[model samples]
Target: MSSAPIAAAPAHILELARRVLEIEAEAVRALADRLGDDFIAAVGLVLASRGRVIVSGVGKSGHIGRKFAATLASTGTPAYFVHAAEAAHGDLGMITADDVLIALSYSGSGEELLKIVPLIKRQGARLIAITGNPDSPLAREADVHLDGAIREEACPLNLAPTASTTAALALSDALAVALLDARGFGADDFARSHPGGALGRRLLTHVSDVMRSGPAVPRVAETALLADALMEMTRAGMGMTAIIGDGDGDRIIGIYTDGDLRRSLASGCNFSTARVADVMSRGPKTIHPEALAVEAAEMMERLRISQLLVADREGRLVGALNHHDLMLAKVI
Candidate 1:
């Protein structure tokens, strides 16, 4: 008997997937186009909220909901994820009257979520629902219904929630960026929200915050001998020392460093007999203590100096910073 030939998927299946993608892309674009007073009102509601945003969903929607909460929290907004299944088991306590609760369900009828809707309402927390079926029970009960409805799924079986989830994720990102913009949130503000990250160190760390201050600052008077300045440089481990003069101390007369010492010794200058003024490099580069650490890095790169003397607004020596300091603070 001849073996039955293996069946091949019809071209229609592939075509369906492509059509789903195109249709969902249009859905997202339409959502963007519909941005108007309602979008602004939603942002205002979130901004005025005194408590965190509580995101809850069931099944695949639950996974996407967690990511949405994380994205909002990592940006400027305070948000957290609550499992819909857990809501009935006292997880409802997580919701507060001052908070905004966002419920996500593609079908708008997750049994687990429906079990808690009345309780969430009783707690007086405002509810926002994202669902494909605007007339679904959840949407009917929501204070605002965001249309996450998609025409179809990318899955050939048409059973998986594919296009709908993608649309919801994109919408969540749009809301985050819109809120960030509305608050005039700057890079510095973002850095504050993420101090442990590299972007935070680059943006939020100021020269003064990481610089060596007080006794850690390498300093020597101009009248001090070259040997004493060299000792200060070595003891401080900054490879350099600032030379301060008398009076209001507005002037930086000279800077003595390991390189200067080497150059002086090679030029046959007597280290013991030489004064710091006679051997030090005149008018070395300096930076304000309030300058951003990134700006200080740029200055160091331009001037080819590993060490920088941080001065106050009056140009008086306040502290010192080095490339190693930047590296330690992770600003480099």
Candidate 2:
């Protein structure tokens, strides 16, 4: 006979889950209470270092170290990760005297780290240790030791690393945020670092970059017939046309759109004989070529309009764009 499997009740599983969360939350909260001069010193060390921060660790601590390096790098502090074992195998060349070393070890006694830390110190690089035990050799030798010690692991057996890693990650994030504030890193500065992202594109792409210009801009003389204006709008695919003063003049007298055409037809205007200037809307909303694309999107939304005329400093129609173009550019 085959033995039947046993399953824990839903209530029991839920209780276990809640207990794990509570333990982890307590571990993070305890970190704040433990902060003192050492936390401040860690922030100062990174802020004062002229070169990058070199983060090193082994096992689960190594994974947290990678996150620590990324957070610091993204938040205005230059940092990179080096595996503790790899450092012993010639990756130590990446470290320099000007750089600061941040080593992560929950037990403060990873053999690979022990082998690498001494060589790093010999190079004159300052050491900062994030460890669970302050009495460990790693903490004793570190110039500044961050106390990541927790009362116990969230694991029921207290053998697997759980609370300790969470405390270390949170503490490292605190250091990065403090250094970011000290550097006065702003949105513009972050955009420069991440120019390929959507936020960077929104901030850096100008109206002129995406606006239809030159012959693609639908334009007609103010005296042109409604039929002629409609032809230009259809050919340009912008759903609207700019009606400027006669004789190739640069001044935008008004704008005539598909909506205007509809209203004109509703009012019984003769499209064949009526002039564009006679029925077109005057004082149309306009944006400058130098403005950000995101600014143009905002203006269109606020006015409840679909298209905007791209004008120059002198108010001459230089280009044109509509909500469709903005959507295509992913700016809206």
Backbone clash count for every predicted candidate, in the order shown: 0, 0
Q: Which stretches of candidate 1 lie over 4 Å from their true place?
A: 1-38, 48-50, 214-216, 227-235, 246-252, 258-273, 288-291, 313-316
Task: State the TM-score for model 1.
Answer: 0.79
Backbone-clash count (model 1):
0
Give the number of the best model, judged by TM-score.
Answer: 2
RMSD of each: 5.1, 2.4
Residue 85 deviation, candidate 1, in Å?
1.8
Residue 226 local lDDT, model 2: 93
Point out the worst 10-residue segment of candidate 2 by lDDT: 244-253
Q: Report lDDT (CA) for all predictions.
A: 0.85, 0.91
Displacement of residue 264 (Cα, Å) in model 2 is 1.5
**Shift in Å, residue 309, candidate 2:** 1.4
Q: Quote the lDDT for 318 in model 2.
A: 98
Scored by Cα lDDT, where does model 2 land? Answer: 0.91
- Which residue runs of candidate 2 sit more than 4 Å off their true CA positions? 1-6
Q: Please give, for residues 138-237, the per-residue lDDT of candidate 2 as tens digits.
A: 9998999999999989999998989888999999999888898999998877777778888888888899989999999999999899999999989999
Best by lDDT: 2
